[model samples]
Each structure stands twice: as structure tokens, then as C-alpha cells.
Target: GQQVMQIPQYQHVQEGEDFTTYCNSSTTLSNIQWYKQRPGGHPVFLIQLVKSGEVKKQKRLTFQFGEAKKNSSLHITATQTTDVGTYFCMFSGGYNKLIFGAGTRLAVHP
Candidate 1:
């Protein structure tokens, strides 16, 4: 079994501040998926990182995958109220199994 560990179990940031969450795994991962779950809402897929040393950005959100493919990070620049949610990093295992990290809950204050 594989496990993903995420740091900063909780984060509180001002509306214009930056926030980041780290995800690490002891084993190499084929791909990593990021999801955002808003309060009282289902999880929505954000993006997936597959290549080593890959970096992707969507608006103010930045995603990076480590060169070793054993780590990943999600950073939000200039946090907004809409960014308040639990961000999860997950990897798919064989047989339709998905392994998820503990997740980082973000709270934004306007």
C-alpha cells in the first residue's frame, strides 16, 4: 500500500496572502491528482501532475511536482475567499483504488 502525507493540516490566510501545502510519499508515484472540496460540496478535480519536475499554473494557483516524483506541492497566490476549502492530493493505485493524503484545510479571511 502507498501513502501520501500532506503538511499544514490547517491554514488560515488573509485574503491577499499566499498559502501552500506540501505532499510527500515514500514510494514513487505514477501520477498525482489535486482536488478541492468546498464546504458542503463534493470534491472537484483541480489538476494532475505526471511528469517529473513538472510545473503547472491555473490563474493564481501553482502546482509543482518534484524531480524525483516523490513529492508535490500546491501554492495559491493572493488567497481569495473562494479558495477556502480542503485541498487533497491523491494518487491512483491498481484495481480502482485511490490513495489520498490527509488534506490541508484552508481558511481565508477577507
Candidate 2:
């Protein structure tokens, strides 16, 4: 069995601030995927990192995979009220199954 763990179960920030979340796995991952879920909305895939030490960025958001494939991180710059949501990191466990982290809930205020 595989599991993904995330830090800072919750976060609160004023608009225009920065935020970051981390994910770790007990076992090396084949690949890792990041997702964001808006309030009362389903999760939306953000990015997937497969290669060791891979990094990807989308606008002011950055995603990184550890060289050992056992950890990952996401960073967001300049938070906004619209950014209020839960961010998740997940991994495939084969056999049509997925292991998801506890998730980081971000609350942005104006």
C-alpha cells in the first residue's frame, strides 16, 4: 500500500500573500499529480511530474518533485480571494486505484 501525506492541514492568508504546501510519500512514486479544488467544486488537475527532480510552473504557481520521487511541493505567489480552495497531491497505485494526500486547505481573505 502507498500513501501520500501533506503538511499544514489548513492555511489562511490575506489577499496578495504567498502560500506553499508540501507532500511526501513513504514509498517512491511512479508519478505525482497536483490538483486544486475550489469551494464546493470538484478537483481539477493542475500538473503531473514524472521525472526525478522535475519542476513545472504555471503562471505564479510552481510545482516540484523530489529527486528521490518521495516528495513534492507546490508554491503559489500573490494569493487572491479567488484562490480559496483545497490543494491535493495524488499518486497512482495501479489497478485503477489512486492514493491521495490529506490535502491542504487554503483560505484567502480580502
Candidate 3:
């Protein structure tokens, strides 16, 4: 079975600091997706990567997929209070099943 895992289960940073989280898969993934969930809120899709060694950025956020398609990472610059949330990496596990990573919870304090 394919599975996704993430590191640094939790993170805390002062406002304006930077944050990053890593994600790995037990098996090679056809594609990977990233999401952000604000406290007490639902997960919101951030982006999807289909090509190996792909990199995408949105404002202060950056995402990268490994060349092997077995790992991924998200980096955020200049942390803000609104950025506080749990980040997740997900992959399709066949049969319409979605495999999700443990997620990385980030906290930003002013």
C-alpha cells in the first residue's frame, strides 16, 4: 500500500520567520498534492505537482517535488499569523483512495 509521511510534526515561529516541511512517500507517486488547513478549518488545496523535480511558488510559499517523485517539500517565507495551520501532502492510492501524510502543524506568534 502506498503511504505518505511528513516530518517535524509541529513547528512554532515568530512572525516574519520562515518555515518548511518535508513529505515522503513509501512508494513512487504518480502525482502529489499539497493542502493547508487553518485551525478549526478544512483543508484547502494549494497545488498539485505531476512532473518530477517540479517547483512552484505562490507569493511567499514555495513547493518542490523530488526528481524521484518520492518526496516533496513546502517552504514559506516571512511567516504571518494567517499562515498558522496544518499542512498536508496527499497522493492517490488507487481504487479512488487518497493517502494523506501525518501533516505538519505550524504556529506563528507575533
User: Candidate 2, 80: how far from true, in Å?
Assistant: 1.1
lDDT, candidate 2, at 101: 93
Alpha-carbon lDDT, every model: 0.95, 0.94, 0.94
* Candidate 3 CA-lDDT value: 0.94
Instruction: Give the winner by lDDT: 1 or 2.
Output: 1
List, residue by residue over 1-110, the lDDT tens digit for candidate 1. Answer: 78889999999998999999999999888999999999999899999999999999999999999999999999999999999999999997666889999999999999
Pairs of residues clashing in candidate 1: none
- What are the per-residue Cα lDDT tens digits for candidate 3 across 15-106? 99999999998688988999999999999999999899999999999999999999999999999999999999998878689889999999
User: Total clashing residue pairs per candidate?
Assistant: 0, 0, 0
C-alpha positional error of residue 39 in candidate 3 after TM-score superposition, expressed in Å: 0.8
Could you tell me every candidate's TM-score relative to the true structure? 0.97, 0.95, 0.96
Q: What is the lDDT of candidate 1?
A: 0.95
Question: Which of the two, 1 or 3, has more lDDT?
Answer: 1
Q: Which regions of candidate 1 fall more than 4 Å away from where they truly are?
A: none
Q: Tens-digit lDDT track for model 2 on 3-102?
A: 8889889999999999999999888999999999998999999999999999999998999999999999999999988889999999997867998999
Q: Report the error of model 2 at residue 33, Å.
A: 0.4
Ranking by TM-score: 1, 3, 2
